[model samples]
Target chain A: MRHSSGFRAFRAIGLLVFAAYFFIPLLAMFDFSTQVRGSAEGRTWDNWAFMVTDEDLRSSIVASLLLAVFTVVLMVVLLVPTMVWVRLRVPRARALIEFLCLLPLTIPALVIVVGITNVYSWVTYLLGDSALVLTFAYVVLVLPYSYRAIDASLSGIDAATLSEAARSLGAGWFTVIVRIIMPNITGGILGAAFIAVALVLGEYVFASLLHFDTLPVAMAALYKSNGPAAMAAALASMILVAVLLVGLTFLSRDRHKQGASS
Target chain B: MVGAFQDENGALTLGNLDALTSEAALTALKGSLILSASTAIIGALLGALLAYLIVSMPPQSLMRRSTLAVSGVLAQFGGVVLAFAWIATIGPVGVLTKAMDDLVGANIYGSGWLFGLPGLVVVYCYFQIPLMVIVFAPAFEGLRPQWREAAVNLGASTWDYWRHVALPLLLPAFLGALLLLFANAFAAYATAAVLVSQGQPIVPLMIRQAITSEVLLGQANVGFALALEMIVVVTLVMVAYNVLLRRTARWMR
Candidate 1:
């Protein structure tokens, strides 16, 4: 297709408009965080210092890390076996299983919190309000992304052939799955885990509803009370997420290369 | 009912599981569906338009690459920050609202749709467009150059080419993207809660209310039921999209 100058000019204008729209808010956030306390004085590092020094903020960061790790672990434990089983034993139902796994993606976080709270209120009530319930909801929240990554990896492997080979070698179903299939799809599992960690870390609605103080919720609370400190937290979060996104992109690139080589 | 399991000391009991389907639970379920479906439809339409504009542009352009990158970032940057931005832009004391009120005698700030369904839709669109672009870009790339040339060579007008050749090829991808947009919009909570009026209860807001209420005071079971209902509806929509994808897989080629 040939490009025209008119189209080129239009593209430039569109790009500029969209770029400004996207960056202005981010700039505003930066400005809010850096401006001197209470006055329009020039930028300072006070907000960052405050965000780091606050015990509650520090605790929320630790809590977020814990929650994310738990969510990632739970997701892998729940999704990998179910996905492998569906792929190997119930191939025809792969579509159905995939649908069920991704079902959480359709639910709003608040709604899931609502459902889980209702279904597990007795559990929460009994446990005296532990973070366990929030962890379960986070598991559901990351299910779709984890399932997609795992399912895609499963599709790349010849599950039937691998299972057959393992069985002929006198391996039990559990052993074949544990020693053979899992080691093969480690990349996908890792990729999914990374993505799951990011999602769980960023999740706010579920944690807030469940009364757990995850990072995002904590940041939001701080933003309401003290805007500058919240901006520092937000910047920290953005940096963390950017690193994870880069890692995922690299994993995806490696996967592509592996696919091509095979 | 689930609360029934909580003893004086807040311990769990098997008996509390039965509270998952109470009257309050049913109401929350209904509210989630209505809110999710409404937001999904609105978001899907706006997202489709944004995706179309992005994809329809010429290749190798800076605009295309930047749009792609920015959309990727914005799509992920939702929640409280997004809510704050929207308020900054159009809330009662917001720049846009104040300007409009001063210039046109229109009080669009706190009095009108800006704080209600309209505001929700606007916030939903902010996230939805980028998502749609992500999903639709590849679908658009799948369009064969020869098809467009063939349409032109056959004396078809631009409109005819788009209607007859492009739309058919893009329908499956569009539907898939729409399903995703629906899911994202339906599940969204914080943006709406922050931007919209508290009096107008969306399912998420309602759930939050129930959860935050005094122990043994609010209808938490109903909130759970509402969440369940949302899950079911989103599941059904996804299944339907998958079926459509399978059926149209050949056609998309």
Candidate 2:
């Protein structure tokens, strides 16, 4: 493949400019967050250090971290089994399930929040207004992404044969889903979970509008008095999300390897 | 949403929709349309260009994989954090604004346009471009070299090959990605909520106001109708996306 010099130059310049455009603001955030607020002084660790010591910010991060864990668990548990069941037993329902899952994409979070705010008056009365209650909605929020990722994995693997193999060996439905099918599709499940976690971390609408005071909300609140510290938290959250995204790419890629065998 | 259509007596009525056609509601809707459409056009084109640039790189290159992975995260990047970054860049006392002031002796934020639609387009583009890349990058990779090679062997020039073959094949996917991008910007709430504080010039902000801000007796229902209006718009976009996706899948898959 002989590449022309002009074409190569164009790609290099194009990518460089786009990368700069995308990465510069992120870099600017890093730069601004490090510098002392209100004074033109050299960079300091005051804000980044505040991430650990600031009680409210720390609590918010911890709360969001817990929510992310719960959201991922609920998404996998609820979706993977239902998806496996649909694939193995009632394949015709796949389209309906898919449409239902992807419906959240078209329906904005604000609309869902409007319905939930109206509906969850009862839910709050019953369960109390705990941030953990936000997890239930978070699962629905992540469904479109999770379902697509999991479905791609299901498609890549011969899920039916794997399930049949377990069943013929006298495995029950639970064993089939938990032991046989899940292992084969662990890559996809992990990928979906990673993305779910990232989405939950940076989520603001449902949390802020619903008044859940998640990490993003906490950061926004902090922005009024502490600009640098808020950016620090934002930087930290973005890094965590970036790592998860990288992990997801690797996990999905790993699926291709196992996909050949199954 | 039923609450939005309810009357003063809590009786259901279409009067809340009358509010939907109000000057304020219409302004917010117009603001949303302007922001989302412009972001979609600029973001989709920028992303397509970047996707092409990445695809031009060697597949196994570390740069290619890392860029793709980072794009995935950055595409999902929005909300309060994104607003923070933009403020740091262009807001009063912002780094770039200060630097430009020092060098060019011009105050960029002096006009205070950063709080309105112009600043929003710039801020929104940050996520929009990356999102477009995440959506459209795969489409770029799906282009087979053989198509170009075969076209060339058939005596077609590069322009003819791209215009006749590549453009037709890629158009649906491009449109699909663009629509998703539109729906994304249209439905977005947090960034605008944080940045545009003068007034809620967007529907998402309007919904928030209806729900949270100065609670009038009937504004809640009006808010609900506004939410419905947003959903109706996004549904049309999604339906269009589905059609385009089906068309894309036929050729791309």
The candidate maximizing DockQ is 2
Worst ten-residue run, lDDT, model 1 chain B? B3-12
DockQ of every candidate: 0.26, 0.59
Tell how far residue B94 is off in model 1, in angstroms: 7.6
Best by lDDT: 2
Candidate 1 overall Cα lDDT vs. reference?
Answer: 0.70
Q: What digit string (tens of lDDT, one per residue) describes model 2 on residues A1-262?
A: 5689999998888888877777777888998899887866787999999989999989899999999999999999999999998988899999999988987877888888877776566667889988888888899999999999889878877888888888899999999889888887777788888889999999999998888878999999999999999999999998898888878888777766665776
Given candidate 2, what's the lDDT at residue A81? 92
Worst 10 residues of 1 chain A by lDDT: A110-119
lDDT of 2 by residue, B41-83 (tens): 9999988988888888898999998888888878888988889
Write model 1 residue lDDT over B1-253, tens digit each, in one string: 2232232114213233345466655565565555556666665665565665677676666666556765665677677667666565565555466568889978766565666665676667777767777777787778888899999999999899999999988887777777777777767787766565455345566556655768657354444444455556777887888887886678655
**What level of docking quality does candidate 2 show?**
medium
Number of clashing residue pairs, candidate 1: 7
lDDT of each: 0.70, 0.86
* Interface RMSD for all numbered candidates: 5.1, 3.0
